[model samples]
Target: MSERPLNVGLIGGGGGAFIVQPHQRAIHFDGTRRVTVAALHPDPEVAQAEAAAWEYPLKGYDSYDDLIKQEAAKPLGERIDYALIVTPNHVHFDPAIKCVQAGIPVFCEKPLTLNIDEAKQLVDAVKEKNVPFAVSHTYLGHWTSRFARFIVKSGLLGDVRWVDSYYLQGWLAARTEDSGNAQAEWRVDPKKSGASLCGGDIGTHALMQLRYVTGLDVTRVQAHLETFVGGRSLDDHFTTYVELSNGGRGLVRASQIAIGHKNDLGIEINGTKGSLVWRQEFPEELTIRLPDQPDRTYFRGSVSANDGFLKDLPEELMAEPNIPPGHPEAFHDAFARLHRCFEQDVRAYNDGKPFECDGSKYANIDDGYMGMAFIQASVKSSQEGNVWVNMDC
Candidate 1:
């Protein structure tokens, strides 16, 4: 007999929130998981009304505390299998740590929490609980990302030397927050969005892409967090010169004040022998340039093993399920892939089996902590006259 579907609960995703929609779709992508309960808003009436009007049937609670307390008290199989925390930066740590303490697995949005201290606490709670925890680094779900990781880690790139990883956007080129834009409003507010705006918002995506692909950590950084837009306390443009764990140097930067660039996130890693380039705008393919050889481009669902520089493709990577080439896997597909991988770990945890919440599949608690640490370090570095700061703090 087939296994029953996993039931998911939402801590926040109402009040016209944006990230929650894609997450809900990703949760239901495989039909093996579904959202059954939610604490949609802080206001009890608003939460109930929103839940009642949700696209599907679901129970709603006034707050995450009530939801966690009630659901966690239930016997296994009767309660939500896991919780998805889709709240704002300030709201993340409380519900997430509570869920962890309640022995509920959590899939949370990125930047982990508002600051490194909260992130550290969440990390400790997760470690103590030993529950499955995943941070939603959506782009890491791309097959091309995994493929890039393989190519670089497999020694095909011949030791990484330099990297340029960036996420650029024009959305905040002006003061959109003053125009009643909820997303823009909170993001520019330091109390809600944390210390660095551009860096915490999308810079971490660029940082994670570089780390995910190169398998290297940024050890130190000299950063410049600039607020190009007047009246914003936090930065609209963030740049950092980083020292990698392997002694190589690179830049991990992001800009929200760049006009005409819409979600233009990309990475280029240059090594001693070859280089690899990938752009999220063109998610379907990755390019590799090697000296004295024709530039080789590999598309999703079309790569072959034993093709000159590419050899012995891992059976697992090759067999990982994806739509056929030309079907075009995009944003929702990437989100679904993350949820799909996360589902396996959740199921394993549910079964009391040895599960892998390793960073290989999805961003785990450690990766989340690292992101927080990176942001903290970058902010400190910028505040100290753009001086280099060690990441150990």
Candidate 2:
């Protein structure tokens, strides 16, 4: 690891923010990345309260530009190495471009920016600076998900035939958009949410997860996106038929108005010889079905069942010292593990040593651009009576 800690300046993490707590916890989970929240730019009162709650004592600013300037004035070694962008979709581009242009790396939230044009600009900025960047596609770090990738790579599945994935949530079932809920308000507004709500927000997660596991690029997409709630401008539910680059077929569906469904993101892959099923709700288990034998359940930390990736998980993340097998680890723990890997890479880069996990191994600027393209293609296809549109990125 590096001899010096990487001082991190957070752009938008305030009190009552849903993601601020998790971001702070994940950053400090590993001792290697000593993240000092040098500056926080939120509402003055909210920022002070959040700083107190997280015990961050460096400084607090209401102006994002002032924070950037203050951090830039520090000595070379003491300057911020990265800025975490966790603001709303509409607020993503400016801070991201500013940070990258200032020669600081960025760990941006999903969707990159509000629209394709903004995303393209950010992508160009990253390339121009040649600074390391990453997007938080945390599912790529799940033990079982990585194992699924291994299964496909091992050819155990034997020429994958199809993939089915879904991400459903019921949080916005009601007219929360009309009720002025800040998160839902911006999410349902076309100005802030962009073209397709369901596709832009969470459908990107499903697509990224599927591509990561199967190593298949989407060649084309035929989509039907809808807004069920009255007076809503953006789609609340979306379904798409996908053709993969390797001649495989797939289906993706995401809905926020699905009643009684809470964070139910699941994927099922079918191959010539066998099949695999995994659900985010029960993230620790992977169901496998073989041609001849009955179905088997593979747990995260199982000795008899786990593949190389699962067995190679950090010792502390294992299920237990001794048990029958097939114990479960929760989702937050998986997210923490992803953060740990990111921290290792940051430290390695600082120390001029080989990074543990390649930043490109996870999502990056290209993935963000692809996601924007997916959103645009889905919206266009939906508008054109579910016609197929090429997403050859």
Candidate 3:
């Protein structure tokens, strides 16, 4: 039997779009999944040029509504199987809801929707339609994340007790939010960006990472979220104390206005027996510190130290990989790996087989809901003078 290819319609991808290219490349790179750009919706000339560059025979549209309407007119099987929403945070909900209601699956960018209510509405729509959907939380795809999971599962880090995670950046240190940098503008606007800027944006990533490796849900949080950059409508720094369901404690901080910092997201988890640390800057190496033995370092793709999950990566990706044992795989590779997992699960869903990664196992509607809840609770707590807020995720 021949496998059917998935027709993908992209909502945003103009000449200078940042994320669309990675999504396109990831979908096309895996031969098992033949992805065709069914339609590109942007400024007509730019979209047409992009389609031509990709060698897609499809035409381009200037409006998303036109693209959706035309695609919906096709028969179910011939219609676009999935729509990738690569627009900004504020632009995510409407296109996604339309696609899901039309019986097309959707892969949306992170911070699923603008706020808790919007996120819930999108989740309800997808559930009502019973379509397979996913959100892009790319850091969960890192090799070091896989290794950290192994250490926790193997009981090498017995009974995790505490976690410390941070995501810091220097780009917005000087109030760039008001300068109309397309990305920064919407993100700092309360109307478009939703509440809790730094926490709502990158804090979701940190929370997802914490849960992914340790399998613990955040039960409550006491937070101090600050808008350090003068005149910015949203937060630039977030410091929160988190209580986990499994009796573990955690501290999470995300800052976009921190001067002199780069893209630094690092996590340290301490357990009864030992501790494990992974830093995004050093994506290939995991630090292991045991009570009885000297601290050790585990490297990705190493014959001696590679864990099962690391060893199972596609040979092509493993061969002459960007990282040596001590070197690192950059952000794009992590994004690609996540896209690969999304593709596998989507195919499995279409084929009536068990999903390669359980939708619930990865971050899903519930995680999105929880992330929003975290944002709301954190903000409420901050306004109330740093009181503890219960999160019902």
- The prediction achieving the highest TM-score against the true structure is 1
**Model 1 clashing residue pairs (backbone):** none
User: Candidate 2 — worst ten consecutive residues by lDDT sum?
Assistant: 316-325
Cα TM-score per model? 0.99, 0.89, 0.87
Residue-level error in angstroms, candidate 1, position 215: 0.7
Given candidate 3, what's the lDDT at residue 100? 78
What residue runs in model 2 are displaced by over 4 Å at the alpha carbon? 1-4, 38-58, 305-328, 352-361
Residue-wise C-alpha lDDT for candidate 3, range 1-393, written one tens digit per residue: 766667778887654567777777776665544444434544677666776776445556656676778787887457676778887777788888888787777888878888778888887897787777878777776766765765676676789899998898888888675676777777788877888788978888888888778878889999998877788778899999999998889998899977888878889999998888898887877888877677788777673534532234434434534545545566767766766667667776666666534532346666677788888889988999999999955
Candidate order, TM-score descending:
1, 2, 3
lDDT by residue (198-268, candidate 1, tens digit) is 99999999999999999999999999999988888999999999999999999999999999999999999
Ranking by lDDT: 1, 2, 3
Per-residue lDDT of candidate 2, residues 162-200 (tens digit): 999889998888898777678888788888778888888
Model 1 score (lDDT): 0.93
Query: Which ranges of candidate 1 are over 4 A from the true structure?
Result: none
- Locate the minimum summed-lDDT window of 10 residues in model 1: 318-327
Question: What TM-score does model 3 achieve against the real structure?
Answer: 0.87
